[model samples]
Target: MHSLINRIMPSASGAHLFAVVALAGLFIWFGLMNLAGLTEATVERWLQPHPLAYLVTPYKTWLPYALGAIQLFAGVMIAIYAVPQRWKRVSYGLIGAISIASLSLMFTNPVWIESLGGFPAIGSGQGLIKYVAILGVALWFLGTKGANEIMLIGLILVLGWIGAMKFTGPEAEGVWPLLTGSPVFNWWLTDFGKQMASNIIGVVELITVILLTGHWWNRKAYEVGLLISAATFVVTLSFLLTFPQSWSGGFPNLSGTGHFLLKDAVLLAATFILYRD
Candidate 1:
């Protein structure tokens, strides 16, 4: 199995390039969402529950927008960081800023314990907690020379397990709002109703897992899996635009649902790694 994986995986340089592009895309996409007020709920949710929430309460009106602009700038810098020898250092600075901003959420978010199921149990907070791994990946990409196959395996397990859960009654019901709001998925709800629509999505995700894991055995299957995985994230990420309620506190406070979907940013990045490898 190890030999087969090595044979199928992309060359080290190719994988590294793919990872950079994927990370840049995520930063840009997420930054735009913040600047456009699409992720206002998320920003608010993260800030309002922090121990120092009162300190920033006075600047609440404009803080999110300012942060959004920073995000956008950092993403652009990261994208072009390697273009010129001088710009490389600037890019590292931007990456540091972005990393600090994201990792700081660990201290600010209240749901870290209960919603994420504490330490032993992985629950809804899995979305937020996964940022730790993302941070590590960023560090690895910046400092290391080789691919981290373990990260790819981690993504497969998380996505596959979550995809499988979608078939269950509770899981199906959980995604109803997202399905109803999504233009791509809304039709499923209209045509098949909630349960079946959820089941359909489940099947798609399961198939994605098969394709991802099958890369060791079938190159064609891996290519198809990458396509499906990209499409899935595109559809899921669109929920930020379609669902107004995803922003629980009007513009910036993310409700439970919004928080749940925000993690797709990391998942989207992971997809790129899998696609190349």
Candidate 2:
């Protein structure tokens, strides 16, 4: 057992391989569970409390399958290929397709936003993030070995979008009641801590992106890129867990579609770590 444990322990690349496997498993498991006819009540009781699950009703039926397939492919590539040079381009293409389609789906469907409340700018900004991210993915696909800089640019654009969306517009029309604390844990929009946390994270991410981009030509570029990717993975996972697990299923749960959106982020992170090594 000791020897086996040592064997499985990660190398610089292995760390990323393990993460890819875990991520793939989560996608397959959650996706399969939802596709199966498991009772929502039972699943909820077993999983613990989360934001409403019924909200993601529209996208869940298809999105999970897509995600599961991607995760599975990613895990397999990492495991089978010691060096990702050949597979890297394929992975980027898959991720790019997923990102572009997911963004289109999100913007093309207004029912979800309307079901809650529609802010024009928020919708527009989300579209922009996906657009820029697609460009970032394209850069990687073009065999730019140091594609981290492009990714950093994407992150900065996304962070700006996030901050602008959260801190301004209809949501920010009024000065907050100081008494209402930050909405850190609450899944709903009303929570002050949650909004503040989102904005702060966005700002920090913007700085990180800028630094990572500036360091692209530096000798330590790969190292810096890996750090940025790790930070993003943490944030994406945190966002996933912070919201209700069912949120991915439909309406009240933005987490479902949101998870698909993060798919590229994960792929990008993995790609960078691999490229750096």
What TM-score, over all chains together, does every model reach?
A: 0.58, 0.48
Off by over 4 Å in 2: 1-11, 15-93, 103-120, 124-146, 169-199, 216-229, 245-277
Per-residue CA lDDT of model 2 for 134-229, tens digit only, reads 445444445666554555555555544454554543334321221133243334434545456456545655555555554446534534544555
Best by lDDT: 1
Candidate 1: residue pairs that collide: 40-252, 41-252, 41-253, 41-254, 116-125
What lDDT would candidate 1 get against the real structure?
Answer: 0.63
